[model samples]
Target: MDHPPRIYCYRCRKPDLLCICADVTPVPTRFGIVILQHPQESRRTISTARIVSLSLTGARLFVGLDFAGCTALHSHLAAAPGPVYLVYPERGALDVVDVMAREHGWPDGAPTFVIIDGTWAQARKIKNQNPCLDRFERVSLSPGAPSRYRIRRQPRGHYLSTVEASVLLLSRLEGSEEAFRPLLEVFDRMIDRQLSFKSGESRRGVRRPAPRPEGG
Candidate 1:
């Protein structure tokens, strides 16, 4: 009889579903994260949402624009009186920088970040797909360090993987350099583990190795 099929950990790629090496500690914060993931991206095994969800307390991940199935996000926005800033670059005729500067002095409260979670091209598609989002103030981060996401290629320097952008924003807003450090570390470690696994699998002439026995 054939053995049960092996399953990879979605986040860590380990034979074990839950990796003990990965600490599931919590970060204390009140900031809310609104992740708008493209449908294709949402199903990928290595998407950044896994890390972002584990890192923040008020994190909400949504697959599309309608907000129909994303009840949590809808409720958050409906109840929130503060301004919502779409974290995307300004396109032709869409000047986010100007709006951000003008709304800087709003008396009510701090701004919430709405990140578009996809590649530069995919993100642009998201923006184009959702015209209702035109009114939101787009808060683009000035170009900086290159992304640490090794799997995907980005055009020139116009791209930042979602996690990198999140860390930068959190650092600037909350004044915490360590805001998303753990998540970044986890990502780096995951890459290293995946690379090692791939190298071994290549040598064995198989796509995947026999999984370690359960409780072994």
Candidate 2:
């Protein structure tokens, strides 16, 4: 039997047909971003955390559930030039836009936004397991447009992908949406390509073989 062809895009680490690296552009930002990604999310072909890291200059990506023992994370957090805030939707979390407005464009100082990249359950698990995250101020996004991550169905209508959340946060902080709009455009194109691939698979009508009888 002939093996399948291996055509991979080294930059994105995705198969050639699903690669979006050529369409991406890295944007500069005043605020720092730290993405704590669950190990499982990092392996997904459609993971947006990688896109987020690639799109933003100086953004950091760390993979794991427990960061309390991570000296790198501790050092990064400690060296942050300004305040550190966790982007989460916990009960006491404040709306990020509101927080920014009240401070008059981050008067306290530009913030280092830490985002947890994972599914809802995985994100919650990371938060629960990582004691180091407790030291940061928690922030949430105000109700806005619905998520455009069409390939994956979210449990709720309001839950945005990690990249979407990051884009919104950055747009709001900069007081203009144009800077981060390219990331959204890239995300949209990625979804469209994936959907087309799925449609092609459906048209091809690939099916599993039926089980044989126990008594042949």
Please give, for residues 77-102, the per-residue lDDT of candidate 1 as tens digits: 66655678788766533243554466
What residue runs in model 1 are displaced by over 4 Å at the alpha carbon? 1-21, 65-71, 92-107, 207-216
Candidate 1: residue 163 lDDT (0-100) = 72
Per-residue lDDT for 41 in model 1? 75
Q: On a 0 to 1 TM-score scale, where does candidate 1 land against the true structure?
A: 0.76
For model 2, how does the per-residue alpha-carbon lDDT over 1-216 read when each residue is reduced to its tens digit? 345785988777677998989888989998999999998788677888878888899899999988878999889888888889999998988887667766676665678999999999999999999977898889998647788898998888889999899999988888779999989888888888878987887798855358568475
Relative to the true structure, how large is the alpha-carbon lDDT of every model? Answer: 0.67, 0.86
* TM-scores of all candidate predictions against the true structure: 0.76, 0.88
